[model samples]
Target: MSDFGLGVSGLAAMFALMILRMPVGMAMLAVGYFGIVIMNGDRSANALLVTEAFSATANYSLTVIPLFILMGNIASATGFSRRLYEAAFAWVGGLRGGLASASIVGCAAFSAVSGSSVATAVTIGKVALPEMKRFGYSDALATGSIAAGGTLGFLIPPSTGFVLYAILTEESIGQLFMAGILPGLLLTALFMITVTLVTLRNPEAGPRGAAVSWPERMRAVLRAAPLLAIILTSIGGIYFGVFTPVEAAGIGAGLIILMALVMGKLPWGVLTDAVLDTVRTTAMLYLIIIGASVLNPFLALTQVPATLGEGLTSLGLGPYGVLLAIVVIYLLLGMFMDGLAMLVVTIPIFFPIMTGLGFDPIWFGVVAVILIEMGMITPPVGLNVFVVKSVAKDVPMSTIFRGVLPFWFAMAACLLLIVVFPQIAVMIPQAMFR
Candidate 1:
């Protein structure tokens, strides 16, 4: 077969393995190994795999992933999630659909500290689901809000997705973090708007609510102060060049551990669990990185993405047209693929195309993350949605899916706004760099 044909075959086999429920890293590794062997025999394949494994694993930039993951895991174990929820609830729980809105706000805050979408979903779900259910909120509303809100885990700073994007595209992680700020806030605004409208239209899902006492609200805010400090220090420091991304992550993780110790949240067992979780997650991500190393070069050899990009450029499509096309493709793929796997598989191909088309890599990274965030709440393969459903086992999957639709629309609208006015994503980063 032609080299191009070999690439195509490799892709088909990868997807088929995915369909059979194989792990994403294993699927990629398997396809990559066989594809190399088929095209150039056994010795060539082993040589490629050996080299890819060492180089990808030993990458210095990759160190940021585990540090960030350790930061998140420590934060999770330190009682910060509860504090975030309590703070948001105290301030916002007085509005209509207050608890639900609080859930989203809490999810956003939690996401600032935690990078995994499923972790955000499950962690916040444990805290907010019971409260919402007790307050007579519908299963759909409770499950949907948490699921959709959890997608912000990556859209916000200190995100694994952002880290990966930076490493892949060779953009400054600090600049990308700054670029995500407005877009992340826009998404939060959109989700809150969606929640308010839904509650107003159907009071059954969320009845009118009372306000909180100023004193209690202040106390809640105080409880959340440590987290706010960590977020600001990590993200703000990076933006201002006070520290590099890995250094910021280490600082954040250290602060979180200190807070946990002070608050009596980190007993010996809890500390052990936090460390173990971080190690496991970091190990899993490293495996995927190695697989991507083997796979990315093969995909590049196909030249399909470059050809398609050239075709689009040759068609005289404007930047907006190219951007729109990319979003549409992500939406279609989101239906079938896990976001991380999709990102790992597509980014090597798409990043070059995007840059070749004159889009800024940093801007495209945020935009790509927004699309991935949407996928986190999208159906069939929506990881966040599934997490919510798992937590709220009593809630029907259909109800959760239906409830998620409005938030999906809100995310889509946010994506459109970012595309129409690039400044929304670029302003903070540019200002910081300047």
Candidate 2:
């Protein structure tokens, strides 16, 4: 068979394995290994696999992932995440749908430390849902807000999505982090607007919360000061060039641990669980990276990415038209594929085409992350929606999905704004570098 045909078959096999409930890394690894054997020989494939596995695990920059994750896990365990919501609530809870708005605010704050979308959703949802319910907020609004807000985890600084994007594309991690900030804040604002519109139309849906006294608001903010300071210091440090991402993550995680210890919040058992969870998550990410490494080499041998890029460029569509087409394809695949899976599998094929078309890699990274995040709240297989359902058990999946639709459109709007004014994504990074 032709090399291109062989590549197509390998992809089909990988998808088949994934559909059969095999782990994503194993599926990619299995396809990559045998494809290499077919195209070359057993010895070549063995060497590739061994080298990739070792290099992926040994990479120093990846240490940031575990450290950021540990910081988030410790915050969740010690109730620091809860205080973020409390602080936001004291300030905004008096507004219509304010509790839900505070959830988005809390998610945005927590996302600075926690890069995982599911973790952000789960942590914020658990705290916000119960309180919103007590306030007689609509299920659609309450559940929808948390599910949508959780997506900020993927678009914000310290994002795992951007990290994987940087790794796959070999772009600067700091630039990608900078690119994400404006877009993240923009999306957060859009989400809050959606909540305001929903509550405004149905005034009964999100009632005005009792006004908090200025003294209580200050007190609440004070209570959340430590985590807030950590968020500012870590992200601000990266912006000011005071620390690299790995260094920032290490310092942030260490500070959180020390705070928990001093406050007597970290029990021996909780610390053990948090450490074990971090290891488990780090292992899974490493496996996925190794699988992508092996698969990329095999795909290169088959010339699939090059062929795909040629095909995309040959279509008479100008650059913007081609970009729209890529966006549509991402949306369709995102309906069924998990966000990270979509990133690792598709970037190898699409990244070259985009750069050839003259799109800024950093700007595209922000757009791509936002698009994938929208999928996390999109229907038929929305991961964050399911997380919301898990937290709000009595609420049907349908309600959560319905609630998420408005926020999904809000994300779409945010994506459009960033595209029309590409500088929004690039400005922060450019200023930082200059």
Candidate 3:
């Protein structure tokens, strides 16, 4: 068979395995391994797989993943998530749909610390869901807000998506981290706007609550100071070249541990749990990376994506059209596949096309992260939605999906803004690098 035909068959087989409930990492590994063996003989394919997995996992840079994840886990265990929600609620609870809005803001703040989408959903949902419900928030509003808000975890700095993108494209992690800032803030604003508009349209979603005094608001902010400081220290440090990405991750992790210990929040039990959780999460991420590394070389050898890129370039669709097509494909794939899995699988093909078409890699990384942000709140296989659903079983999946509809539109608007004004995503990185 032609390489293109082999690529197509492999993709179909992978999807079928996904449908049958196979683990995404394992499924990708299986298809890629077999495809490589078929394309080349078994002996060469085995050698490549062994070398790829070892090199990909053993790289010192990948250690940043576990450190960053540990920082988030420690923060979550230490009750920072609760403080964030309280701080947000104190400021916005009086407004219509304020609690839900606050939840989104709180989630964004948490995202600065916790870069994983599903982790953010689970952590924030645990903190905000009950409080919102107790305040007479509907199941749809409360659950949906958490689901949608959790997506910011993948956009905000300290983001795993940005880290992975940097690794895949061979871009500087610091530059990508800096580039993500404005886009992340834009997404936060868009989410808040969605919440405000929903409340304005139907006040019932947000019951009138008591406003906080200025003094109390200040106090609430003070309570949230640790998280704010942590974010600024980690992200700001990286952007300003005060530290490398891994160093920043280490500093952040250490600070989180120190704070937890000082506050008497980090008991032995919690520390143990955090370590275990981080290990499990990191292992899963690395497995996906290993699989992708094995497959990427094979895909490159096929030369199909390269040929397609040339074909598209020759058609003169221009950079914008190519970008639009990529975004559409990402959105469609998101409905059926996990965001990380989809990113790992497609970025090898997509990033080359994007760069070949004259798009900035840093800008494209932010764009891809935003698309993943949408994927987390989208239907069928939205990971964040499922995370929230697992916690709030009383709310049907469909209602949670309905609740995120407005926020999803807001996300689309953010995407359009970045597309129209590429500078929104690129300026910080360029300024910093220059």
Candidate 3, residues 20-112: lDDT per residue as tens digits? 998878888888899999988899889998999999888877877999899989988888878988899899988888888888888888888
lDDT digits (tens) for residues 1-434 of candidate 1: 76777787888999999999998888898888877777668898899999999988887777777777777777777768888999999998878899989999998888888777878888888999998888889888888899999998888887788877876667888888778788888889899999999998898898545578999999999989988899889888888789987888888888888888887888899889988888888888888777887887677776656776787777776877777777888998898888888888878878887887788888889889989888887878888888888899988888999989999999989988888898999999889988
Q: Which segments of model 3 are wrong by more than 4 Å?
A: none
Instruction: Identify the candidate with maximal lDDT.
Output: 2
* Candidate lDDT (C-alpha), each: 0.84, 0.92, 0.86
Backbone clashes in candidate 3 total: 0
The whole-model C-alpha lDDT of candidate 3 against the native structure comes to 0.86
Against the true structure, candidate 2 reaches a TM-score of: 0.98
For 1-434, candidate 2 gives per-residue lDDT tens digits of: 99999999999999889879888888899999999999999999999999998988788878889999999999998999999999999999999999989999999999998998989999999999999999899999999999999999999989999999999998988889889999999999999999999998999889878799999999999999999999899999999999999999999999999999999999999999999999999888888898999999999999999998888789889899889998998898778777887889988898988999999999989988988998898777788998888899999999999999999999999999998999999999999999
Give the range of the ten consecutive residues with the poorest summed lDDT in model 3.
201-210
Look at candidate 1 and tell me the lDDT of residue 107. Answer: 86
Query: Which is the winner by TM-score between candidate 2 and candidate 3?
Result: 2
Give the candidate number with the greatest TM-score: 2
Clashing pairs in 3: none
Selected candidate, larger lDDT, 1 vs 3: 3
